[model samples]
Each structure stands twice: as structure tokens, then as C-alpha cells.
Target: MFDGPSSRREFMKAAVAVGGASALSACMSRAEEPIPKGTDDPSSLPERQHAWNDVLVHDDAGNVEGPRHQLLLYVNLDHDGPPTEDDRRVLESALTTLDRAYERSHEGLVYSIAYSPAYFDRFDESLPDDLDLPEPRSLAPFEDPEFDRQDALLHLGSTRADALLEAEEALTGDRDTANTVTMESPLTDVLAVDSRRTGFVGAGMPAERQDVAGIPDSKPVPEQSPLFMGFKAGFAQNQATEDYVTLQDGPFAGGTTKHVANIRQRLDDWYVEQDFEDRVAEMFSPRHAAEGLVDGVGDNLGDSSGLTPDIIESIEEQAKQYGRVGHAQKAARANRDEEGNVRVLRRHFESTDDDVASLHFPSLQTGISVFEEVREAMNGTDLTSNPAIRQRVNNGILEYIFVRRRGNFLVPPRRLRSFPTPTGE
Candidate 1:
């Protein structure tokens, strides 16, 4: 997020010292005591752990505020089998990986960390997925109505850093971009452009980022999110879904979902769609197992009842929701059931050639941290419930962390992709 490469590395290294090796050893040292021979079982765990990453926020100047987004993650509590010790190892690996990534980051240019609890947290554990899969909506690819692309200022600016430089230029009237370079404290380009103040994520922010009425706290839906807390995600399933409502083409428009999808729905000018969803593969049609998180979700423990019982029940519920179901593209909305199970129902919607774009996260931390929490909270005896089969506790964490970090990485590659696009056209 900061500007200078070297400074970023140093700052990240310090952050790593706090979140990774140091924290991990503290946990492992206490539990060095071995599990009882007869009580070993893998069927009682919640989920697996996978690779970890980081999320660091920076300003246009040379200040960085970080929770290192990738360091934290969410997990599926409900599974066919119990969570395993291997799952815990992966979780540890992820934390270590994130720290390493940060330690390797550049520390010069714009850098500084906003000190705030809402923006960052380091914890022992959290709740896992129950019978329901989290509601899915657009994750990122935020767009500007004026520029008509995923990012606002960058689409309209001369350089990739234009957005971040907005603040410095405005305050000092300094047109010289090179004059502001700093090696120790780098700044984030995201803070410069619009500088609208990211609510809770911002320094001295007064209110929480606005959310939809019912989205749960787990998914870190930003105030800019189109969905609400408790009801944050949308579900659409096959068998239980009603027929897709045919849409009529009337006068309609598309823009940021945060504005139109709620209060102005009755009007013809309002409708929200996922940003560039058509370009990416979401909700696989002939969904083959793209990634294998579920390779071991179900393992026998010689009995149905065991650790992570809630997660097992949740997966069962999810299967039932999509049971013998079908889908139609004409009209559909993704959502979850009363039990937190995901469900998608076709609905009438206004259509336009232009797709509606919205940012999905900076979702709630609760969802991301759920798995490790259970890993820590569960009885020490239960940790080895299913020693036979290894659980990938970090799988969910990997998914969310990767998604979050991808948004950052995409900043550069996406720009690179755009450079040649016009020439080819």
C-alpha cells in the first residue's frame, strides 16, 4: 500500500514480528503436551487451514496503517468430518506466510498505519460455518460512475499513483510528484484519489461503514457494501428456486450499488449488478471442483456426533437447499436460508447491456476469524478427535485472504492488462 519498496519491506517486517512467528510460538509452546493415545480422532474438527496472506493500508503521503488484511481469515465450521490437527498446522502456516510476505514488502515512499481496532485484530479463534454457506455477492472491482471502470481516479488519472497523490497535491499545491518521495514512511495510493474517508477503516472515523440491513458480522462487508448486516449475503439455489422472472427493458441505469439498490428501487433508474462478474467465473454452471477444499470435508470418525458438529450439520443443510434444483439466467438473486444455508431465487429485474458493479469486502472480521477461534476454544482433548484424517483448517482462510489480497495485486496487473487493450481494439 505504501510507495517506497524498501521502506515497505522494513515496515512489513516489523508487522510480521508482531503477527507471525512470535505469536505462533506462544500458542504452540503451551500445547506441546501430547494428546492421549485412546482419545485421538479427526472426525471432531471444524475445517482445514491453508496458506495465509496480508492486507496493509497506506496513505498517499508516507504513512501506513495496517491490519494486514491477508493475515486474518474465515473458515467453514460445518463439515462432513471433524476438524484435524493438520488443519491447525495449515492455519499456523498461513499466519507464518502472511508475516513473511509483509517482511518482504517495500517500506519507502508513502507509508503510515492508522491506529484503530476496527481496522485490525489479532485473535486466538472465532466461530466456524454452521449449516449455511455464507451469502455470496460481488467482492470487489469497485468502479467510478464517471470513469466507467472498476477504479475511479486511476481510470481518469495520468498515472497509477494519481489517486493517492490527490491529498498531497491538494494540501500543498505541489505539482512536483517526485519531490514527495520518502523512503522510510511510504503512503498508499488508495488514500490520495477520492479520499472520501473509508468510515471505520479511516483514522478518527465517526461511524461504521454502512451495511445492508441484515448481513452477518462475519463477512466484512464495507459500508459501501450493497448488502446489510445479518442479511449480508444473497443465496440462490437450484431445486428450491422458483422460475426466473422475465425482465422487461425499461429506462434503467447502472452505477455503484450502494446508492441505487436500496432506497430507489421503485424508480426505473435504479438497479445493481456485480462488477465484471460476467468476465470472471462465479457460480459455476457445470461446476466442477475448481479448488479442492472439500476433498476431505467428510471423513468417518466411527460416529456422526463429534467435534465441529455444527459445521457438519451446516454442510448437510447446504446440500439440501440445492437438491434437485435448477437455474435460469433471466432473473436471479443469491441469498441464504433461515439456517444460514445459501439459496438463490430467480427474481424479476431490469436489464441493461452495462453490468452493475460493486465492491464486496472489507467484510466483517468475525467471518474471517471464525475457524482459528474454534481451534483454540475447543477442548484440548477434541484437538485430536480425528487424528487419522488431516483437516485443512486454513482452506476458508485461504479463500478469503486470497480474495482480499488479490484486490491489491490486481491493482497492477489489471492496469497492465488495460494498457494493451486499446491497441488490440
Candidate 2:
């Protein structure tokens, strides 16, 4: 079904979204070059599982570029209660096989495994007092999103479609080996995959897949936009450094908390009713639209969104005057700490899973409360006092985006990634 006149990248994206053994075989047949091999020494890898910036490619503007294709495997422990040492060894062997099979880079494979609060509850001991992992819940009053209480979340990302598919097959026991590396064990020996989601992010990717349901038939997604919203995001200046989000003094000190949300996008009104200027106003800030600060897909902004403190401070006045505030503007109010450091690192990607337009949002921070605080600011509940800004209508992109699912997890240090206990056994 992915066959057509589409570019190779586009075809690979389609294959990933419709993943299976057949898709993997077709992807392998289309490979133009051999994938880079991984290291035999697992000790050489970063201690933090979320560490990927050093090896990832960056744009000319110095902004970090995420992998082209991504996959999420939400799995549950095959048996109830705490896991046994044998289970831990089985999972570790399966993961280490992946480490030896593929290079830990965007061109190869960069992945992380995180445990949910539900998974830790099975253990008698509780998490460290300093750690702040929490159960997922709705952040806003208007939305009712399903909570993901799975035992663990395994995130895999790579530029090569075949690499992602082969790694997944190896973990699920579908294949005996990945990249010619024999698998000592498969993850299914200890855990069963409860859900699988796929997504992509890169220039020209969103435009090629705009035929989905939530997007309008006009195909208004920009060819240069990495996201379906026709704009660039993840500005380096606006993002928190990995060190800031990592737990500094706990057993999981080298780790961090991750809040993952699946958001469904309805772009009919976003693209159909609004023009370029209107979108710029709602996406960035009204001042940006008036001063012509943003260009096509916002590549001209460089490493920043150009949201100055004054622009963020004038949100109320802008709402009263322009009758609209921006998505970035509202979120910026609480994104910064008292010392002016960014609080969360957002690693979001667009998706066409289930033939619908959606986004897989992964945010890393020191704690789940920090993410909740930033999300509350994004909700723009306080901005409703301006009368022009209702809960969703003129408050930002809320009108076009709906939260579908939310989950929180503790990304332990690499040493404890395999079915770790709450106390880091």
C-alpha cells in the first residue's frame, strides 16, 4: 500500500505507520546502504537513557533534529506483582542485543526504556522521597484523556526504517536476530506489548502524509514544516538542558521523569479558516505576526522562537487587543524557572497512526509536577479573565488540538532500565 511516486523517505514513513513483517521486508529491500553497526561494549554507552543530543544531527541553525522515524511500545509484565531476577536478566539480554546490533545514533538507533508508577506499585518499597513520579491524569478541565497504566514504555527512534522494524521484531521474538546479531532473549519472555504507536518528524514528512482524516483535503501542511501545524518547533534556546531535567541526588540520579501525551490534531479550521499571518499570531504571539518576525515554517528564527519576556508579559494586552494569544506565548509564562532556565525539554513528533493526524509528545523534566505546571500554563486558564480568551477558542492552538492520552514514567539510569524496582535494586 505504500507503493507510489512518493519519495523514499515518505514511503519509509508509510511503512513504519503500517508496521508488520511484510512492511519490514519491503523496507529492507529498498535500503540504499548498509546500516551502521553498534558497539559490543555496552559500557561505552551513556549512563542516562535519555542522552541522545551528543550523537544526533543538528540543523544548520544549530537546533537539534530528531530521528526521522519513531516507535512506542507500551508493554505489561507477563505476570503480576514484582519481577524476579531471572526476568530482569531476560530483559537486559534482549536490550543489550539491540545495543550490539545497532549504533546508538539517529542514523542507527537511539532508544530509552521508562517504568510507570503502576509498575513500581507492585514492589513493597516505594520510590525515593525526592523522586516525583505520579499517576497520569487529565491536566485540563475540558479534556478527558485515557491514562496509560502499562508497566513500561519502550521508545525506539532511528533514521532508517528497516533498523526500527528489525529491532522491534527482535524484541518481540518475531525474528531470531537483528542486524545479524543473535538475540540471547526477547522482551516478550518477561513482558507483553500492550500497545504500539508509530510516528515521524522531518521536513517534507508531514506534507507527504497529509491525506489523513483530521487534516483537510486541501493538503495545507507546508512542505518545509516538520510538524502538521505548518511551523517549526523545539527551539534550542527555549529547551532545557538535559542536566537540568535529570534527577541529581536520587538512586535514579542520572535519570529523569517523562510525561508522554498523545494529542489528536484537527487542522480543518487551523488551515482553512486562518491565513499565514493568523496562524503566526496564534502559534507564536501577536507581536510576532505584527513585526513580521516569523518566516516560512519559522526557520528564520534560528535557535529561538523570538518570544521575548516583553512579548510573553504582554499576553493579556494582546488578547484584549488582537482577540487571540499564541500557543507558545501561553506556555512560556510557566516554562521558565525563577532563575530563567527552561524547565522542560520537549521532544514531540507528528503522527499518522490509525489514519488520523496526531502528535506524540514526550517531555522530560526533574519531576512530573514540573511538567504539570508547564501544562497548566499552556492551558491558559488564567488568561480567560481577559474575556476575549475563552477556555479554548481564542486562547491558542487548544481549539485545534485535543488530548487523547497521557502517561508519566520514571526513566531510570541505564543500569536500572531492565524491570527496576522502586528502590533501584
User: Judged by lDDT against the true structure, how good is candidate 2?
Assistant: 0.92
Residue 350 accuracy (lDDT) in model 1: 15
lDDT of 1 by residue, 274-375 (tens): 212210111211111222211111112121112132333333232233221111110111222355432321111111111211222321111212212222
Number of backbone collisions per candidate: 115, 0
Q: Write the per-residue lDDT of candidate 2 for residues 1-425, one digit (tens) a residue.
A: 45564666666776788878888888898887888999999889999999988878899888998898999999999998799999999999999999999999988899999999999999999998878998999999999999999999999999889999999998999889899999879999999999999999989899999999899999899999999999989999999998899888868889999999999999999999999999999999999999999999999999999999999999999998899999999999999999999999999999988899999999999999999999999999999988888999888899999999999999999999998888886
Instruction: Show model 2 residue runs off by greater than 4 Å.
Output: 1-7
* TM-scores of all predicted structures: 0.21, 0.98
Q: Which candidate leads the pack in TM-score?
A: 2
